[model samples]
Target: MMKVMVMVKATAGSEAGVMPTNELMEAMGSFNEELVKAGIMESGDGLKPSNEGYRVRFSGSKRSVIQGPFVETNELVAGYWVWNVSSMEEALEWVKKCPNPMFEDSDIEIRPFYSMEDFADVDTSGEFRAQEDALRHTLSLQKASLNNYLFFSGRCEEALNYYVQHVGAKIDLLMRFSDSPEPIPEDMLAAGFEDKVMHCEFTLGGAKVFASDGCNDGTTLSGFSLALTVATAQDAQRVFAALSENGQVTMPLAETFWSPLYGQVTDQFGMAWMVMLPAT
Candidate 1:
C-alpha cells in the first residue's frame, strides 16, 4: 500500500472569495464520497485563504517568518488529500476524476509518502517500524457513535418503523414495555401501551440513535434537530422531499453557504430533520 499526498493549488478566485457555489461544492463532495467508499482517501481538507496562515523559514539557528496573502498563488496549496493507493498510477486516476476544486483553473500534485520500509537499510534494528505500527493503531477504526436520543409519547414504534423504511435505519435492539424484566411501573407506561417501545436502539449510516416510549403524553420535540449526512445531492433532494411530504418544511432544501443541499423539515411525527449532501 502506497500513501500519496495530493496537493491542490490555490486559485485566484478562491483567494478573493470565501465560498464556492453550491453546484461546485456538491460536485466536490460527490468526488470525496467516491474516494471514501473506495478506501483511497485517508483524509483531506481545504485551507483558509493565505491571509489566515503564515510561513516560517529557518537558516542555521535563526528563524524568520512571513505572513500570507503571499505574492505567488501558484505556490500556495488551497487544499490537500492524503490517499492510500496501490501505486502512483492509481492515485493519478483518482485525482483525474476530482471536480474543479476551486471552481476555476487549479492544479493537483501527487507525491508519494515514505514508509517504514524505506528506512529498513539504515535503521537495521526495526525499532522505528515497530513503534509506527503501534502508534498507527491509535488511529484505527473506532466504535459506533451514539448521536441522538428521542423519547416518544407511545408512538415510538410507529416512528421507529418509519425511519427503518424511509431513512435506511436498522433496529439494533428493542424492548417493549411488556418485555421489561423488571416490573415497569404502570405510570411509566400509558394505559393500553404495554406493547409500546420501552427502549430501542437503531443504526443509521453506521451511527447509532436511541429512542423510547415514555409517559404517552403527545410530547412535542423542540430546540434541537437531527442532521443526516448523505453521499449525493440527488439523495439529499430525495430525502428532503420525502421528509417534507405531509409534514412542515421550515427551510426548503436549497444551496447553502456550507452545504450543497441544506434544509430543515419536521417529519409527520414532528421530529425536526436537516438533510444535506456530505460536507467537503
Candidate 2:
C-alpha cells in the first residue's frame, strides 16, 4: 500500500486575494464530501493565507527571530489531501477528479510517502523491527501524525567515518558483508553487491550511530536530515570542521546556550550533518 499527499499550488492570476466564490466553494465542499465517502481520503485541509505564516530562526547566544509576510506569491500552497491508495496510478485516478480550487488552470503536485521498507538494508528480524512495526501501527491508528525529524538514506558510512576520524568517535560495531554471521547468499554475491557494508555503527561521545549500504535505488538524498549533540564547544568545532570538509555548510558553527556551539552541514555524500555541544 502507498500513501500520497496532493498539494494544490496557487498562482497569483488565479488567486485574487479573496475567498473562493460561492459556486467554487460549493463545488469544493461537494468534492471533499465525495472523498470522505470514498474511504480513501485520510485527511484534507485548506491553508490560511501565506502572509499569515512565519519562519522561526534560532540564533546562537541571541533571542530567536520570526520573519513573516512571505515574498513568493507564485509558489503558495493553497491546500492538501492525504490519501491511502494502492499505487501511483490509483492516486492519479483520484487527483484527476479533484475540483479546481482556484479560478482556473491551477496545478497540483502529488507525492508518495516513504515506508520503512524504503530504508536501505532495513532489518526486519529482531526487536528493533517489532518496535518499528508497533510505532507505525500506532501512527496509522492516529491517522499518521507528523514526526519532528525525518530520516535520511545513504551517506551514513561517510558521516560516521568523518566523526570517527575527526570528532573522537569510537567504533563500537562495524559489520560489513564479510562480517555477517552466515555466508553471503549466493544470489546476493552473484548480484555483485555483496561487498557493500551490511550494518555498521560508531559510538560518538557515547551516542550510538548506525548505518547500512543496502536498499538504495540509485537516487540522490533529499527531504531528510539528522541532528547530533555533543559535549563541549571544542568538540563541536572539531566535529564540524571535519564533516564540513569537501561539503557545504548550511549553518556556520556558532555559540549557543542550548549548547555551547552548534552548526549544520551537508557532507560530501549529500547527507545533512549537525553538531551541538553543551554550554559550560
Candidate 3:
C-alpha cells in the first residue's frame, strides 16, 4: 500500500477563521467515519487559521520567525489527512466522496509520499533505510493498543453482570446473537443460547474489555491473567477479596519486592486475574 497526504488548501474564508457549521461538521464526521471503515484514513485533523500559526525561516543557520496570516492564501493548507491507499486513483475516488470542506470554492490536493524503496539507488549502504524502518516500527507501536477478549460458553451475560457487581465494570455495548447483522449458524449455538451475548464491550477502570458467548463449545478461560494495578493497598485488598468470592486464590495478597500488595485469583466465571498495588 502507498501513503498519500491529502491537503485541504486554504480559502479566503478559511484564512478569515470561519468555523464549520453544525450541519457541515456532521456531514464531515460521517464522511470521516466512512473513510475509517474503509481502512484508508491513518490520521486527519483540521488546523486553526494561519494567523494563529508561525513559520521559521533559516538563512545559513540564522533563523527568523515569520508570523501569519501570510500572503498566498491559496498556497496555505487549512487541514490535511495521511491516508494509506492502494493507489492514487483510489485516493482520488475517496476524496470525491468527501463533503465540501469549505463554505465556498476550495481544492483538495493529493500527494503521494515517497516510500523507502524509492530511495533504493541512493542509499547503497542500507543504513538510512534501516533507520527509517526502525522509526516506522516505533510509530506503528505507538498507534497500536492491547485489550483482553474473553469467551464465555453461553453465560456471557452472567459473566458480565458478575464483573459489574465485583469489578465495577460498566458495559459499553452488548449485542445478542439475534441482533447480529448476519444470522449466526444454528448448529453453532446450543439450544436456548440464541439470546446469549454474541459480543459485548465493557470498561474496567479505564481499560476496555471484550466478551462474547462463543459457539457454546465448552471452551474455558485459562492460560492468562488480567493484571489490575491500583493506587493503594486498601484498594488492592478490596478488589482481591471481591474477585476471591466463590473463587480460588492462587496466591494470597502480600508485600513483595515489586509491590506493597499483590495476589492472583480465578474469578467465579473461571477468568484469572492479578491484583496489585505498587509501592509509592
lDDT of 2 at 96: 86
- Superposed Cα deviation of residue 13, candidate 2 (Å): 6.6
Q: Which candidate achieves the best lDDT against the true structure?
A: 3
lDDT of 3 by residue, 128-241 (tens): 998986676555435434456677777788888999999999999998988876667658788887888876889999989867786664656523457666655556666678
Q: Where in model 3 is the C-alpha error above 4 Å?
A: 147-163, 171-202, 209-280
- For each candidate, the alpha-carbon lDDT, in order, equals 0.78, 0.67, 0.83
**Model 1 lDDT per residue over 89-128, tens place:** 9998998998878767789998899988889998799888
Please report the TM-score between candidate 1 and the true structure. Answer: 0.51
Which stretch of 10 consecutive residues in model 3 shows the poorest summed lDDT? 137-146
Ranking by TM-score: 3, 1, 2
Give the Å shift of residue 59 in candidate 3. Answer: 2.0
CA shift of 193, model 2, Å:
70
Quote the lDDT for 101 in model 2: 78
Least lDDT summed over 10 consecutive residues: which range in candidate 1?
137-146
- Of the two candidates 1 and 3, the one with more favorable lDDT, higher being better, is 3
